[model samples]
Target: MMKSKSKILVLDDDPNIVEVIVTRLESMDFNVHGFTDPGKALDALRKDSYCVLVTDQKMPEMDGMVVLREAKKIDPDVEVIILTAYGSIEGAVRAIKEGAYDYISKPFEPLELVTKIEKAIEKRELKQRVRFLEQEVGDSIEYRIYAESPAMKRTLAIARQVSDSDSTVLIQGESGTGKELIARMIHYESRRKRRKFVVMDCGATPPSLIESELFGYVRGAFTGAIKDKRGIIEEADMGTLFLDEIGNISPEMQTRLLRVLESGEFRRVGELKPKQVDIRVLAATNADLEAKVEDGSFRPDLYYRLKVISIKLPSLRERKEDIPGLVQIFLSEFSRKTGKKIMGIDKRAMNMLFNHQWPGNVRELKNIIESAVVLCKGTTIGPDEILLSGIREQKEENLNTLESQEKNLVIQALKKANWVQKDAAAILGISRRVINYKIKKYNIRPEKVN
Candidate 1:
């Protein structure tokens, strides 16, 4: 039996031909509708959702071209197959040029007709599946992270655990470390998943307008304020508001934000009455808030409030083990988008990726892979195609400076304490735990280094 829920509309103008086609289709367990008049067939198409339309080329009221065009108007996706007794090249070409799926000769076998119908239905179903997959992948945030390293795993685990709460979360990480992506993951996995997730870049917005953007203004509150507007916080009511680069906001703005976090109430500009909302705030920053607080720039109280639940993200260099997996994800995405058959990266290219320090983190790696995929002509990506012109030199300089500073500190501490772990920890004014962590982090083998 045919597994499809498809109904075939057969319009041949002759009752005998229509009967034969309908009987054959029904024998194969297909739902078949027969029509003798082209006008009646077109009217039926408008009323019902038929999968395939088999219409005779020559008719009294209208030709196959008219039926095809009218049927397409009713359902653009409907597959229309033209049946012509003359089988003339001009007629076949015209039928096809006018949007007919395929032209079938009148003397064709029943099996041949069935084959064409089956192929047409399969094509439509394939297209529908592709659209669905695209939407699913586009909307999924889990696919965006694409992590394999333990550091990333730990970060994701923390995000998931805190998603159920409404407490303000502070995410501290370097630029392009997927801070926004993690913010989205938290929103999508939360109880308020169905609500809006609004993002505001505190650093990008001008100081003059940042307040108005967060707590909107009323009509005539200021120049160009013709109408009352809703701020991002209000828009994110019963949802999540992600404030990126939170450290860049002014001290006054920080105080305002503190009030909102404490009471969930804020008034629109020029409004006396306070408006209440149920919003979850997730703030991200790359700056050292402790240092900022000490310098009397960021409010210490606000900093403490924001850090109630803090998650520090590991940079790409710290989690280099995840690079191969991330590269694969980007390759698959770009290959699907560009209709390319790029299978994987060569060892030389992969090694180059692993060696390079990604200061911009995952975002930089993704951009590099995208550029390579676009420029590559072959199936696999090679080192020659991968461009790292300006980034490589800067990364090398930064890496050298960081390593030299770390090596000097470790060497000095070891020398001052005569290579004793406890003495070294005491001299550095750090705990034994921290000394061990740094030793591993910097790959400091003091005995072999000297």
Candidate 2:
């Protein structure tokens, strides 16, 4: 298709050359568009994205130099390769000066041209990856390292210790407790750090879509499957796959995933042939898999297979000692993000944050700080800038009101369920997702009730 990432635009005045090049690249799994006219090739460049431009130096309309310049304007990232006459140093040098990636001499081996195109693709990807990593660092490196509390220190220690192992790890915690962060820490510290660390939020993804997303599908796997597709598992073949909300998946889906864990081989959707992968799996869930297994909603065998090692993250309220450190880190982080010179939080705001129930945990704290930084007119954030239906407002409201009653009801159910969200949801006749949302909404916890 025109929008495919691996598409190549091949332009040669000679129809035979275009045909040969297109056939070769197509055989190697590239989506290629061949054009004999310089005008038509330029039009195609405007129409779709292409990874490389392979163009002829000698043309009646315009030379490869002109085509290269035009292609660069269309897509600055497009790598260009000029087709030059044998021993034509002038043309090659001109092409390079004009920003062509490389030049291929006429009558060159098809394999040689393929080799250069591969390198051009590699160079382009390297540049894009560096840019992506820069953005990630700017966004998250701020609060990722704060371990001021003993609970947090213990959690991080377990993560670091398991970085050297290849066993499956089950991370248990409440939502917004940075389970993915811990998983990322394990992956980036491991031997496969250079490879991809693929993540899938199993709870957010629908049961109907889970199969094809995890194992991928071969061409003609189903009616709408136009081409072979790589799933999240395939993308993380040599590295790690972090499945969040693992307990939310269906019984049938769990069996399929268990196959991948027990054996490295898995069959893609509608494909008979089994493919193998080498990957360490790390699964996280706020839901209690032990409770689910007891109820027969989650398979016991699959649960055991995934929990070779386990780490439980404490809620923000349990580790309130880290609040100030976390707030300062977030202040600096959001200051950089919003281009604000915010210096600090006032004592009242800091006190409010410290005393808040923090039902949404560290993630809630980060969001509140980001919001405050945006609203902050001066260098310091005051009490009013700390926006929430939190402790500040809770103190000002009546205990007998609907909001108060609802908060008490949630905490009562939570205590009865032993703080397991899935069990608590069952007790309240609500979905686990709903209870999770209500927890964040009302900021409910036992410590806040008294």
Candidate 3:
């Protein structure tokens, strides 16, 4: 087992320059490998992973552009910086079009060269971090199941175990449950990680274009077909395809999709010979697909085919135990993003979050946190920061029944305690448990107390 190092392969015909570059890069704490021959450099690239390739544009056998093109073929993500003479600026521009990161003109200051190298490396590191994070998020099969509930934990475990296989997946969940995230996770974790992951929202897109988009169309296939285009199935060949809200797709499109899944062969809009592709289908639905099949709205065979490995995401209310954690997570994330220094939510604000029936599920909770983060002023998020319309509307309706003086006193207590019953009880010189029973009887939301 060979250890990995941050190696930079320096390919320049000039021996003195290579030596100078190598010595400087080594001093900057980089592992340097120099090559005069372009052929040998290509071979080294194949044998090892180099963080960046610094090559002169004018070489003996192959030029820098040619080398860069070949290097990209080996590893498309490897950053390439071209060294061009002062006269070859036009050529450098063309090289950049072919995917060179940047070009340095000859007769440049040594400090300027070092600065360019530093910037290039920094950019590469940032790209690498984003890629790793995206992969981690995409690879986690349980991301859709955000709760820490035992049922969700078990569901995630099953998803992880089955992600390596090429089996079809059927994701069942209510509206706003993240069924699509689970499908993305399976695709990212599977053998087809490098290929395309296409998503088709069966309910959103019109039925007329669904078939063409899924299968693809050739030049002159229709009035708008000016060029040959690969269908989504072909685009997703050797990868995964996510069909969202599958129950809403038309019967014709469903039949076409079923045929492709069954035979791994389908024709383009105007093409005769059937094209074959290796694609994994991941289908999701908020509707009861089995009921739809029974009622003749969905195909029975397709339903069974997609349900080879089934998983369902639970609603947020059913997993109320995880609400505090979820709320804290959302607050931190939103605060950081919005540049707010909100330390934590007040006790009253916390009560309102937990007691409210989250009809919109986790998505609603996240939005609420984001909105609060935007409006919050100081370090701590107080009850006044929660501006939920439902809570405000209910509070306004109840305000008219009480005398102005009495209402003011109750509002003062609620606001002072930040909505927690025990704290409010202490302020009013009452027992904690009695305050709790009163909270229930009065239907007073913590955020609504003021």
Query: lDDT values of the candidates?
Result: 0.80, 0.81, 0.74
Instruction: Mark the regions of model 2 whose C-alpha exceeds 4 Å error after superposition.
Output: 1-143, 387-450
TM-score of each: 0.58, 0.65, 0.58
For 1-450, candidate 1 gives per-residue lDDT tens digits of: 133457799998789999999999999988889999887787677544577999888888788888888898877778998898864757877878878889888788999999999988876656654654464347563347876889999999999999998888999997668888888888879987766678898866778989999998777889999856778887677678999989989999999899999999988887788877789999999888999999999999999898889999999999999999898988988888799999999998888888876655776677678778887899999887775212232345545654554445555566656778776666444457656766787777756677
> In model 1, where do residues sit more than 4 Å from their true spots?
1-143, 388-450
So what's the TM-score on candidate 3?
A: 0.58
lDDT of 3: 0.74
RMSD of 1: 18.8
- The residue-level lDDT of candidate 3 at 22 comes to 83
Backbone clashes in model 3, listed as residue pairs: 215-231, 216-231, 348-418
User: Which candidate's TM-score is highest?
Assistant: 2
| Candidate order by decreasing TM-score | 2, 1, 3
lDDT of 2 at 348: 89
lDDT string for model 3 (366-439, tens) is 65676677778888776777753122323444446323423343344466566656665554433565456555
lDDT of 2 by residue, 10-65 (tens): 99999999999999998888889999999989877764456899999889989788
